[model samples]
Target chain A: MPKPMLKRSVQQTQTNNVLSVTGNQKQNNQNQQMNKMKIDKLLRQKRSKEYMDALHKLDVGGHVHNQNKVDEITNAIKREFPEVEISGILLGYVSICYLGKPYEVHTLDIASGIIEHYKSGETLPNGMEKARGIALHGGYEFIEVYVDCCRAVSSNGTVSVISI
Target chain B: MSDRVISQANLSYIERNLSAIHGEIQALENDVDAVNNNVKVVYDQVGVLANEFHEFVYEQKKANRLGQAEIKLVQIRQELEKKYGHYDIVRRTTTGILQADDLGIVKKTTISNATEELMISTPNYWLAPCLVALSAWISDQPELAEKALREGIKRNDEKTSLFFAIICMRANRKSACLKWAQRYLANQDEENLDRKAIIVIDAYANGLMGADTEGVISREMTKWLEELAEKPGFVEQQTTQWTEAINLKREPIENSGYTYLPKYSNTWPVLEDILEGANLHANILAYLMDIFEQESSSAPIKAQLDKILTSLVTDFDDEELPLRKKEKFEQFVVEFCGDEDRARQSMAIEETAFETHKDFTQLLTDAAMKPESSHASVATQKFAIALSKEWILNAYNDVIAQNRMKIPTEIEINVDTFNSKTTDGQNEAQLVNEFTQLVTKEKEAALAKNVLTGFDKFLLIGGAIIAVLGVGMIFGNPLGGFIAVIAGIGMVIKHFNKKKQLVINEENIKKNYEQKLENGLQIIRAILAEVVDFRIEFAEKDDESAKVVDFLEQITPDQYVKNLSTSNRRIKM
Candidate 1:
């Protein structure tokens, strides 16, 4: 319950960092630690606009394209789960996990699918601690992902759904 | 053995060695005491620093949102103006026509020439033709007025009818006002009334429509209720919405009020929510009463008509809704920049209230409460509340029941390194005992780890025995036995000193733990007392719900019309 997961196994196949030998682990092993620091330094330099473009090819929040997609999926989710008065759909990437292993980044749809699974007797998504009746912040509910990046209300009909 | 000789200097030397070990123990005890004493102060400083960090983040977010939202506004306005320029002109011209009368600078012919120019310039614009009809009607040109009115109505009948209705009311023509209003209402689907229709309803409910004395509009309202009631789950949906709306009126309790409960109690989230929920009963009543108590607008008829017309002009046309929705969403920077969750939730509610048509209940409620936008007068608020009292009460009841079920039997208070619990503050003695037990278990575990082993104790005792044997042999073998005596004496002194240090270490552990337990007990007592106060306050607030009920009971729609009706103006006629 502490970690939100993806419904699709394909989504959880640990995204390989081809450039780094160390997989972001900070451990007691000196060799791994040194290699991790070296790899992280390189990655930090690779955060230029061109690198970001090459890595994030799908463009999770590409304004018009993603906005339209968010609108489409938001409507679908609302129709499918009318009881959940979603405020709006957000299209962005979130980090998720399978079992206990983390996949540093995944499309928001992976989390969306997990929520759909939550509706059908599967485990509730990890970040949604304030879902449904448990919600109390202003009589509105929220999902707060306290873990690093994976931090994953309608009014009396005043609010709506989020898709991405 | 009977008379082993020992020197006075040797005895004084032993006294000095034992005294040094006692002094060393005292130093370690003092160090532990100092650390224990500073724990609480250090913790308080950390808490303060955390609050300061929170303040920094909040301010930073606010500043960022401001900049981002400003940029969004500039972009949105540029688009809104470019695309909706034709619609914009109609709204601006409507206000100008009314303002021109007071200015008396523009002559009748000049006004005619301008309206004709606008019509030619903005072809196929609906309200432009409506403005021409209004100008013709005012100028007493019957043929031109009829022709323009037909054209305006043909373009948008609902808005044109509403336009003429407000104009007729301002001119004090009661029969024409009534007929035009009924015509506007006639075209509306009860469930899908135009967004602008709310303004008309607000005016009617406030008794500004002097002709509705015979209950013609009242019958239409009753018909709306009948139709809404016939729809399945309609009442339930209203209940949920009304509950949320009423809950929204509750002001949050100050965080510092129950300062330590949030820090100590795991149940604080639920506890906090229940307190607010309990307060809702009083808060919502006061909100409604405040509405009822505010003074009604007494603006002269013409001036009031001008405000209504201005609002109508500014209201978006059906064609502009898609773009307007985007504009409205971009209006808030935090939402526009990245806090899409808040933006989405807010827009959902806002869209419900102002963007689209809704049932009579929601329309009237918005008209009553969100008066700046919905334009419901004070009298209309009273009328709407009295009309929707049943739904309001049911929703309030549902909310109360839901909160009651979440009440926990026992609250768990988690202070640092201590887990204290209580069913209520009455369990103070039990809580103190439990904390002491936990402290005892911790102290015992630590002392156990540092205690001298069996071999060290055997060496300490065994060394003194050997020292005595060597002293007995001192007289027997003068130099050789004396060397054995010195070696045995050194071993005994070394272990005895070590044992003394271990005793001091044990005492320090005991003092440190006992002091920590005392601090935890103090925190528990302070937090427990607040828990008691919280319940008492919750009860006092919960009892105030009856006041809202009693207040609502006194409200009647018929009584409101007397304060707001234009019948006084009509009687003089």
Candidate 2:
């Protein structure tokens, strides 16, 4: 019983509604993409304790020049922070080198190695050598190794509380 | 024909019905009183428990038992956390009892709802909103707290408005609070009791905002002192009492006759100790010298001012400091002005100033430490001593007034204006007697002002309904017009009666307000006199340190005229 113009108007409204719904879907997809990008950027910028520890281990591993030992530590880091995507890895003279996500990584296995050295009642320098091994194997350029309560070993081989 | 048909019984029936309604209203009033009492008792009990908890924590800390203190704190936090409601709705008794600072220990987002249900049935009571706002502030959610304050302000009551203004001031929204206070004062009657209270409150807020309080404070002090001079032995007694109290390291014994001591002595040793410190004196010197520097002059005062200023700049070299360090110094100044914990660093600046002005510094210190041995000149020194005490006491009162202004609770709002009428014969007198007992015990006159009028609307509505019923009867049958006429007359009579009672009630409240104002003024004067007495005694003891006084008098810069004469002599040479 509706007029022809009225019927056309109703049809036009339905079509517009469908278009708007698609538009909303597209907007939501863009938002999700933006959020993912933001998260990725933040992850890249963040320099956490794990990253510092990883760097320390890498520097110590370079000093020791043990390729197999360094490779094992890198594999351990790969399993720990799975969110980090690795780019490349290489073993060079006087250093077990690699390239990957600019983020920190340390595993339970690496932590236990440091803890065991402490359990043996060794001096801090001896325990730090264990931390250096993990850092070298992990190929971390900037890292920190937790030695004991309120103390940590940095890539510089300095044992102190975190201030900056 | 309708008038002729009017019956005496109809009129009697209307009167009887009206009487019954009055009885019901009285009963409702009694019920409200009982409920108010119950709420008060609960609040009092909670207050006691809170005090006990505070004492327990204090004891634990005093013993250096951190572990026990931590446990106790956690237990308190857990209890508050359990009763937490929605973030926006602060309508919970437990929320009121929970201190805002303690709420910081709990997780944010614990509360889930904006409760529409009022915590207390008392109209215009803002206890819940204040609690919620404080809790939100402690949680670092200022926006949410501000929203709660806005809601509290909607009550449109003077005490509530004043409370909000204080909160705003605390939040560092100084200009906003000032504007609100100005508007509040503007709206009040010139002679309103609340106006005087608001004036003191606003003045205090102004001081906190770093406004110069010297002008208003001087006027108030002069007025109070003049009034105090009339009271025999009052000033001398207060001075002795406060001096003794200070020596004993205890609060001054309150003499009921000297009621103003509390208000006047609010600043107590706090401001005096600050003035004694090197920093505040340096700041005052800096402020004074800065003023003279702006006004070009050839005088010894100007010369001395220039020396102090130049030394400060060269020694500190504060201008050349890095931007961040300069910012830190500015922050220190702000803290010092606020009298906050961080202001300790600002006080250090005073020590630096003292090093520069060693003689002046030593003089003040010696005067405070040394005793007066000038017994021969004691009578001569009395006037100077009293004058000096008055000046110092007024200055101290200024600081106290400003500090008290920062905390709104320091100023008490009088809410005892609500009183029952004696217009309803025996019933009216009985009601008045009942309310006097109830109100004195509960002390919630503002709440009474709001809830007590609830029955008036019902009475109005009942009278209208009776008239309507009479109209309905007449519309159905012409012979029933007499019933309608009687009902109409009854409605008019009741309406006039209620209106007259309202007018009388308003007059009574107005009279009470005037009386309370006078009483408030008297207390404030008493407070000023108390401090004057205490400071005078302290100055009397220091009067014996004549060497320092003589040194200060000789060394202090002479007038510009004298300096100009010296300059003329030099030019002649």
Candidate 3:
């Protein structure tokens, strides 16, 4: 009876050892697969446009626009705001302000153009016109355009294009 | 029966023991497997960490390389900016010359060219910084100017001398200015020999020292003007044209059938001639203004000049001359009024105070009206002609005077004194003869003295070959004698080889030095381009971080390889 009991205990111990070893191996394999997934996720996050935009926003105050697009937008602005000083445009665009007034509409139009041009490859040749047309089409033509543009600053200090 | 009982018990005991040992062994094996797995995990982590570290290092190095390259690019750009900026100054100086020349002030040509060349050929290291300093100097930023000038000197830049001279002059450091001027004069090539640079230097030095340098400056100015005047068809042709125009008679002489002279025919040409003559006169007047303003001026002399000016203006309205002559007369009046002092004074007056200087204003108004005279029909006919003549004559005289003083008739050197004091053996007689010859020949002086010295050094090396031949002859062996004979012949060949080599080396040195300077200048230009681009890009960007990163990425490689390759081709002789 003693011998049989001893043998039974030994067998139970061996089985336990094998089970532990197999369990640990399985856990390790799972951990590796999870880590790989996490790395892939991080890489995808890094490469995303949203991530790049966030990085850019942190660095410079304004959104980036191609030189040609900027010229077109400025030209449109000039046509709309003929009475406005050209110096005002440069300062407003660069500092995003115009004589103590926020340049939200101008900033937003520039941002929308950047996104349209870079991400969707959509051409916004007449960004100012489209913006004005949209506002007019929406029955906001009676609004003072320059003043409205000035009042569209967001909480993040970025100017919004819809007001223009 | 007893043996069977004992064996069964032993078997049972052995079996139980074996099972326990087997269990222990399995546990140990599992432990080992766990340890192995942990090691694998550690190894994998370590490998990833190592790779990341390596990449970080590589990235750092890349960034550093980029930074270094950017720095180099900036340096080059700065150099080029200096060079081109100086070139711009040179261009402006050239433009000034052209303006002066077109106005018939050709005496300013040499000085203008020298100034231009000095600006263009300035070494990169000095050019940019010096230009910045110059701009600063112009803007009255003394500290910045000094910093720039010091930096230029530190770089051993050629522009250092020019900048040093300019700064010294500006700072009223007479001794320093003179030192630099003398050095410049000594180094000046033949083309630089009648250049205004020396005159400018002298004037600046003298002004700083409070020395009366007027006599010297006036003399040089006169000489240059005289030379210009001597040029055929300069003033005479214009005078003739004016004479012919004024000589034109309105009425024809009633002659017996065959008329020898046409009366009205001479009138038109005479009027045209007067108009032409007036223009030449205006040029001379303009030249005088430039000289008087630039050379030196005292308040008293400047004041006395006012009276002389008034007389010239009053004479313009003298109605005794013919219509054409009157027109020419009015031109001379306007030309006289165009003098720098008169213009400056006139311009200095407030518009509201036009009544205060009624006499001056009336004179100007009268001259202006003469140009619009109905009788002449041609606007500014008299004033234009006279102004041109005056400006041309003044310029010609000033140039002639300036040249006479600046050009040295003889360069004296004490051979014993120079040789004893300096390492260079001063061959005074030879130097003096050469100096005299150079003044006459002009062409030979254009080549640098270093080139000539290099040629002489090569000849000396050639002569030393005989020593080698003599050595071979000292040996008694027949083979040595044969070698000596061959060596003597070889010495002669070597002499020719060395002479050719010396010329080639000197040429190469000059060429290489110029190339290095050009490369350095090009690098500076590249930097300026980057700065311009950066400014444009930054202006366009809304995100500061993105702009910064973009700018960082825009760093260009700055690797300038100065070629110092010495060709090893032996002489065929």
Candidate 4:
């Protein structure tokens, strides 16, 4: 399930610039659409590193420490992509719930650095389905990050998202 | 009439409205049809696109450029990230490459290096990089691979732990393999790589220990390897299909590359791992021992391995197997490398055959008893004969395989010989004698009984006449007396006939018993002939010809052939 988001708030920054909060909610109370975040090079690099660290941590099987570690990672991700919802940390990877569906981003494509997700009703390539089952049953966690834009980010990395 | 006069205008208005409504309905129908046609066109286009894309994918695969295709997919993933902000993309290019790796393609250092770079470069994508590191180690670049593995471990990556254990296994770094394997077992999910880690630890520990005191540990390790080879690895997804298809036409792909041998202990473990569990065979143990001896040249390792395999190498005679089951148990152990269950099954079958043979021997002894003319005795003889024939036929292959007895080519039973035994155990002379005996006995008994019965009938008739005469005198009626006398004569004749038939039935019973006894003897003789023939055929090939005949000769008329407990009676008759 998608995490409950903070009510959309428009605040005047110290610089008098307007900032709005957007997250997993379907619509703002004012019925306004959430705008996609813009990805600049430096931001991508920073987010990419954080995502890598998160994945590294997940790989090392350390996700089950406590809510604090999860919150820390969740906050870091929320900072980068405010619209991405963190439902909970399951198995060591953050579960990014979308539209009431949770996708596990278990491994990265070394070439593209994109985290993999398996949605319900989607056919996995042959043995991967079984492997996914094993990984899930083995307490493997997944991290799936999707912004309104085509790009997705984890604390350690940024990747372009596509449906295969 | 006046009210109806204004209604014409109203009618005109209603008609106009109805016409307009009909036109609107027509328009709606047309619009619906157009929409349906447009949907159809879109579906057709999608189908074409999907087919074209599938074809393109197939072509790329055929050209073996799946690596490049994966790279392209990764680029698309990156493109999505650029447009959408950093996002998670599934079924990514890495999955396909990993499958290719399982097919022995991903082990190319260049490919693993590329994957490693992508993984290291990607933000927060740490889980898959450990796999890339594994590929590197597989490709013979251990240093960088170990570094990546360490990083994953630092990140608390469970996959990295498994990879490290596997890496340790490949290097023959036994202690490290044990450490990482135990850690992985403790922390790894039961569903994931748990079985794999267990298999590795079991094999390594057992293998490294060589042979424990009983050699049981090594055998267990071999069995574990056999079972492990049957399990499908993660990347085995596509290759499994490819291998199945390929196997239909040619040899199967050796493995899914999960347990490919690594650099350090590549020779023994790699060879051992890829044996498809052939290590579990007795010959394999012997072969290994032989090669080990040749390779080590009196090294301490030789002493250890020798101790380990000595029990395995011991002959069946030296082992604890029963003497009766030694032959079959030996063959089974030698073939299966002392697989206890199969050996036991084999021994069980041998035991059953031996028991059957013993039962047939006892039956023969019973059949040889004098006065074996009873119905039950005859049935026993028939049963024994049939069982002996079946036993010989069934045991032919087993005996030959075990080298217990050999039948020369000329010894095979011809159709005429088989028919001679199968038709009737009795010779023509026995049949004639049986028929003659039944005829003679029936004729003699029938003549004597007929004479006596006839005489008694006459005497009864005379006595009835006298009594009827007296009845006439007392009643003073001749008609009544005449009728009474006729009835008395008919009753007397019927009783005499029944007595004569009883005498004939007794004679028939006597004839049947004699015939049965004769037939039973013939059957026993035929079965004994077969046994004697088999012995003769076997004796011709025996170095100790006299021993074979001597065992057969000891089977006296009163004793069962099996009861002759001579050492030379190895060939069961």
* Predicted model with the maximum TM-score: 1
Per-model DockQ: 0.01, 0.00, 0.00, 0.01
How does the DockQ of candidate 2 come out?
0.00
Scored by lDDT, the top model is 1
- Here, model 2's chain A TM-score works out at 0.27
> For model 2, how does the per-residue alpha-carbon lDDT over B1-573 read when each residue is reduced to its tens digit?
676557666888889999999999999999999999999999999999999999877655544443433454455445433433232233333233232323334443443122223334223445456555655655667887778667666654443455444444434454554554444444443222231332232233223322322333223333444554444443333333323322232223234233343334443344244223212323333322342334322233223322432332123222223432433444453444333344456646743634322121122212222214211111112212222343223232222222221221112212234333221122433444454555444433632463325455555666677667777778677567657657666766766677787667656765665555455445433443444454443234323223322322332211210111121111000
Per-residue C-alpha lDDT of model 3 across residues B120-223, encoded as one tens digit per residue: 46444344455555445544568966786677667644335644554454345555655654444344332223213422322322243233233332233334
The predicted structure with the larger DockQ, 1 or 2, is 1
- What C-alpha lDDT, on a 0 to 100 scale, does residue B349 get in candidate 1? 91
C-alpha RMSD (angstroms) for model 4: 38.6
True contacts kept of each: 0.00, 0.00, 0.00, 0.00
- Please, what is the whole-model Cα lDDT of each candidate in the order they appear? 0.63, 0.39, 0.37, 0.39
Per-candidate clashes come to 15, 21, 78, 46
- Candidate 4, residues A1-164, lDDT tens digits: the string is 23323222222242243332443133453333211122222222324455456545433332223444445555555565554332321112222223234443343322232334445445344223323322331121232322221122223242222111
Models 1 onward score TM values of 0.48, 0.17, 0.16, 0.23
Q: Find the candidate with the highest DockQ and give its number.
A: 1
Sort order, TM-score high to low: 1, 4, 2, 3
Residue ranges of candidate 1 with Cα displaced over 4 Å: A1-164, B1-164, B298-359, B372-376, B414-420, B432-450, B461-490, B502-524, B561-573
